[model samples]
Target: MWQPLKEKIKIHWPLLALAGVSALSVGMVVALLETVGVLNLAPADSAIVESELAPEAPSAVLGLADRPPAQRTEALSLIAQQQDNQEGHRARYLLATDLLSQGRGGSALTVLDGLEQDYEALAPYVLLKRAQAQTAAGQPEAAQQTWQTLAEQYAQHPAAAEALYTLGQSDESTWEQLIANFPAHPRSVEVAAKQLPVATGAKQMALLRLLVNYGLHQSEYGTWLDQFVSEYGSLLTPEDWQAAGFGYWETQRYGKAGSAYAKAPASPLSRYRAGRGAQLDGQRKAAIAAYRQLAQAFPDAPETATGLLKLADLLPQPEAIKVLDQVMARFPNQAATALGKRADRLDALQSPTSAQQARDAVLSQYSQSEAAAELRFRQAQQQAKAGHYESALSWAQQLLKDNSTHQLAPEVGFLAGKWALQLEQPEVAQRAFERVIGQHPESYFAWRSAVYLGWDVGDFDGVRSLDPQIVLPDQRTPPPAGSDTLKELYLLGQDQDAWTQWQNEFRDRESPSVAEQFTDGLMRIGVGDTLDGIFMVSNLAWREQPQARQEYLALQADPAYWQAMYPFPYEQLIETWSRQRQLNPLLVTALIRQESRFVADIESVAGALGLMQVMPGTADWIEAQIGQTGYDLTQPADNVELGTWYLDYTHREYDNNALFAVASYNAGPGNVADWIQRGGFTDADDFVRQIPFAETQGYVEAVFGGYWNYLRLYNPAIAAKVERLAATQPNS
Candidate 1:
């Protein structure tokens, strides 16, 4: 009876169910509303990394001993103190010297007066400056007394002659004796010469040459010559005297019509025009001899090469070839065009089969010539074409070693790497590839090196030891993820497309946060890359938002923030730490990316461990100082802390200059410092370009590049604003 009733109700429910369902839904909603409230949620752990507060462990400490902050600070402070006094004195002297150099002699006098009595040598120099200042200020009596003292005390030095010259009015009788004693001096001769009548055109022209021999670039000699020529126009041959005078004064031989009006025949200009005419007229031998004489006599003269080239053009094939050989041997860059012309002429005269024979003859006779080097390179290329892999590799290697800084070094390094790989020598090949990257990071060879190193070695199956499975992070091989979310978010910032691409690719398969980190690290240390993706993204992002722009400006103001963001590899940090006290943040970032992909515990084939890949010696040293004897080197935070601290020390040691400090960190302080002194590094970039160590050079560049990328992507606004500011400058 119940079953029949339920069936009837279910069948009739459509009509009744609509009303019942509405009431039940209302009741359920009311019940659920009382139990729940609105929920606002953020990430479980949302905190931005502060560059300043971040721990920077000495990179070496990852494997060795670590120093506690108190002890490390104490040690570094003592070291700094040890050199402070000397550094201070040097700084003061430089300041004073700068003031003097800028023509603020009175200010320099005040600084010199403040010097301590202990600065004996410097005191004398300051006194000299004071005397010069007095003279400049028109206090002749005061200046005279100062000069009298300088002449008495510093007689052996050149100061005495200078002082005596300045105070010659003190006594006429004394001045006469002084002139007699210093008769060989120019001032004495000048004094004697002033008593005579002024020189005429011929006499003036002759006098100008005498001044030229003594090394002066003044045009006074030229002025006198012109006056003489104008006054005695009818007495002398205008062209002869004018040409002679031009010859003497036109040392640079940049012959404008009026430049050589006041010199004698012995001048560089006279020799240049005469030699040029002779060579053009086909007096080959005479021209060659004349050019040799001119060039040998006046090595710094601009006409030197002009004469030589003219001479070479006029000579017969045999003599011309000899002259060309000499030119190539001595001045390769200057003679490149001539050498190529000669090579082309020879090639035109010979068939393909005989070209080699002709080149060989040239090489055999002129082994040291630029012509020979080019010929040899061509021969090597031929060998490569013919599949003589070993021969080609050998030749390329010789060229690379012999002319390491040559213009063709990149090409040679690339070829060596390629051929070495073909010959089944991975180590040699890697070295060759490294050479290209190290010496010419901006070249096509560097790009190729990155590609070859980053390619999936596994894809090229038959190539042994390449292991395409092992991919390096820096290479832009396979494209990065094409995630639309990342694209939109990145572009919402500054939208520097090129930099975005680089950042996306550089981050590659790494975690997004880590990738962002890598980008931010590079921008602070001036690690500029035209194609760096991280830099582009950050630049754009900063451009898009005011808040992000502020963060970037803050980062730029704090160098340490940039320092912590560095991705130093184990080997490089260790090397840098050994020499300097601080690490360049860009370099650190690049190394970290390359060595560990930001993984702290990663080990290498050589038994190196932790973030910096420290060996046992490194670990022990770090352990001893920090008293964290049992600390694990594999821990990420620990390794980063230890590495950054050591880097800080390097910076402290070198007074925060990344160049000297970084080089010392890579090569050792003593070594880098010696190189600095030896290399005479007046310009920073020039010094970087001239780094002799291939590994060290590449290490510096990549690390700095990585750091720059980090800052550019994350803190875009500062760099963006910098661009604006640069544009506003008058010179910009």
Candidate 2:
């Protein structure tokens, strides 16, 4: 049996901390991901694997490699016995992988014999594996010859880099060849990692530049950039400055990014970002200069229009008003936003007549703009607060008519439904709720609407114990981008190879296509990068380009996109604990996602740790109550056990009302108790609105929102219901 290994990649680069970086491949093992090169394999001892290995419908012979290793072992071996077809070719290659993993090199060699002649998609990898088999079989000379053969024959391929890396183990010269030929490959990344600590001067800077170019600059990039600036600033080029600035910006080093961008090439985007970065970093003087330069140099550029708007923030009142006037006159697309700002400034100066003119112009000229929608929403909220539901309903209705696809449409529509109910109009309220469910099923409001309309999904009050059934996808979806080889490697559970191939191919870090970005997100999720993966997928709504946004809208219609956004990382543990506590597993999953984005060992700044982000003090207290000790907080099993126990306690305190229980989890029971006494509201929804703590309110909604998403995406019955609602016309 080829058991899975539990070992870290030799050189770990903390994946893009802001968003792009992620630990790699999640199917059958926790393998090295992102910029790290996977150089060696270790024997496994029953390591974790996800559901992609579940049996699939039969058809393609190549897909047999996707089945679970143990389950498919016999089938693959028997298939390997046939030597004439592509199925046999793939079977032999796969069988060799298990053999190599188990250190049965002689057997692996026997199966891999002549595989390069038959396996065209992975011929280079076939050769590379053969070298490993030779070494494992104690035939060092054979391995050396095989490595040299692979490196020479497929010098242009990614596998050639691996061959060079293996050969470089004894001969120091092959490292340079690997670096020269496959600079973006993870193995080349390893070469830089090996040489960086000892190398300095031009050599050190070269290595850093190499790493940065490969998008290998992860969490420590900011520190590296700082060193490059302080010690080797003279060596920097416009491109170098741009790379450093990008790394600094992504890692939240705003101050450094601002300075670097100022020195970078004079692109419209760079100039605008320099000012924005400076503004964010609190350098008002630098920001003003940068923005002023942008206004003068690229007056026609869209980024400059945005830059001028930002510039208004730092300018004096009179100067800001002048800037806004200029923006409104010059940029029609940005005119509404600029006019709204102008109105606010006029109002501040007590010029009501002028302010009213600007406000009217916004509605008359740019009715569909975001600023107009905001204005309408503010009025609706004001009217509702004043208990004039008729006026509120009118404003909400108008806003939806004008800005149906606005970011705030879901909230506004839901508010309209509530206001209609307040006005004693049951039909209007039901219509509003249905429209929200139909048009914005992905929104938090949709879940609230579903509950109000009496969907079977358990409500906040009773969701604690419902055992909703869910069905996991049997296999990974074929990625929308990447070569056929990359897709095959990924879907077949060859995660390590797929990760390396992906990193090598994906060089569009700054701007990527919808397909590329979606593919990137899928790869991240496949490898257990819950945070990076979800962020990449969910933020597609913010796409600004027209075509990209259209593509995103189309992508939204796919169930796989929603599924990728809400994945099941620890299903078994969640189920066991939820059953023990008589709680909903989906609720637990949602809570974990909100708490830590399902990063098993993540720790919060407040000393909360692990999947549930349980406080160490809370863990200690729970241990005292449960009569258990010597548990690690970073481990998923212990953390979920303790976290679920605490969750159960909170649910009991709140009579299993999930809203109050989830609130208590974040805000503490004392604050929740205080709220119940102090809160003066009509019902649970009203209570949520009146919650004093903004963070707590957001946290509560986020958890429940997450719960709703998980339920809809995973539970077939709910998924069908939501899909039906989404497909309906607004009124229908």
Candidate 3:
């Protein structure tokens, strides 16, 4: 019986291979290796027959191979299948969520429209989202109606409350009513208070009082002051009026404060402050007269010093200097320290020549003060601007050497490098660039240096590059084997019959591969057939373009290729990068797929190489700056790490404009930025067509299209919407 079964297995080798080996076989092999005390198999597992096995265990090599689309699509499909999408409801809801994330509120409403009852519990949510979408899509009346309905039907829901608040914000009276009705709601309170004051707690009341007294009011300024004086008259004492005047003076509303202070004659402080306000208001003679009177009325008062300074500064320059000298003589040792400081300030306020003299005096007298240090830096900048490179360099060097840990150390270093470059010192410029890269890899300057040297450009990360010349076949046939293992064996030994079987079986699973094989393989994986999925994928290109997959076979045979494939669990790597960079995992995976297609040594039409498809210029620039030129860009880990960083940089540069930045990465910033300056685009679709470069235009469409599909397929929430949208929207 066993012999008959064996014979039967021999006849149907594909089925037997499926039964004897699988993802589980890879896991078992790994476990067996571990059990034998292999400390780190990464270094010594070349002969391992992990992914080449059959499908008896369906849990092996889920993330192997250099290809990304097949794997990412499979991952998304498997994940979606594991989740429960009840009819079109879940899919619709997911579609709405995805639409919302992608800033497509109107589209989201269309998705939610068909699931009115199915999404009833989420109806208020959908309505609120619809309201926002309506507003964004320029349907204000519709938005208002949607919000009103939400308020009427689901007032208790948070979304309903938010919708109501939004409606109130659209109209002041309605907002006031909302606040009056829902005083406990913070948004209502905030909205009402913005127009009409509402002092809730003690702190709030205090802030309101301060705002009324001192806030920059828009013609409503005097209204608040008048209200405060009327309602809180007892609190508005002479001193309060004086403080209000000071507030007015601080806000440059000297006229209003003076009017308030002039009304309060009992407080000398108010009168003095009012006079100062008058001075600040450009009524210098009036200020001087007021100060003189105050000084006469209160000779020994503390206000005398302020009054004297006002009087002295108001005098002609020569006269003022004479008065300052007299003040020093008469008030000797009484306010001597204050007098000297005042004299120095007055001197600094003099003409530029005099100001320079004063700055030198201050530096000599008080070398440790912040003002002196600022003066020094300012003088240095002036010298640099004046083309006194030697003096500028000397000052910068002195600052760096003296203030070793100064906040301006980097600035000085940059300036020094610039100066050195101006002096024709390439070695110095190179060192400066290296210093920035070494000491501040995260700095904008370092990033600029990398770009200048053509290294690690964020825009070039993970570019989809194919060296159409070398690895690309000259037109070959499909794998001949019908089984994955036999196919592997035949490829290993160049057996034509087995290779043919491989090709036929691969095509049997999916005849046309426009990203559908990815979904099919993932479906197989979801149903507990992991090895089948990988086999379908790794050998997919070979189904029709056997030569392509055959080339991969030869490449895969290299231990280094397996090393790249085995060490990284693709899902885990994607997950880690996505989370750290605040990006979608499937998006990152899709980028990697388009870029290297997991081929660590792939090169592009633009001369980009390695897993992330970095340009040679960028690689060289990065090498020089990092001081680590020994790295092989063909290694997966190095490629991934650098690619991730570059992606992060591009994401940051474009204000998280993934579509624009990704396009820029492929086409070039000159093209993208130029297109952006052209304007008039309403949405991503419009923007896509408006792209002038045909290659970049297609690249953008393909990447984002791929990204959208992956996002929907992998993330259950996104997948649901994608499926629903695919059914409903012609574009999807």
Which prediction has more favorable lDDT, 1 or 2? 2
Clashes of each: 88, 6, 30
Q: What does the lDDT come to for candidate 3? A: 0.50
Best by TM-score: 2
lDDT of 1 by residue, 266-354 (tens): 55655665565445445556556667777777765546655666676665556656666666666544465456545654565564455
Residue 386 of model 1 has an lDDT of 85
How would you encode candidate 3's per-residue C-alpha lDDT over 504-594 as one tens digit per residue?
2343221334233543333333333333444445554343244554554454333323222222226666666666666655556657766
Model 1: lDDT equals 0.47
Off by over 4 Å in 2: 1-68, 71-111, 136-139, 215-219, 730-732
Overall lDDT per candidate, in order of appearance = 0.47, 0.79, 0.50
Q: How far is candidate 2 from the true structure (C-alpha RMSD, Å)?
A: 9.5
Off by over 4 Å in 1: 1-124, 132-140, 151-156, 160-251, 254-312, 316-355, 361-369, 379-395, 401-407, 418-429, 436-732
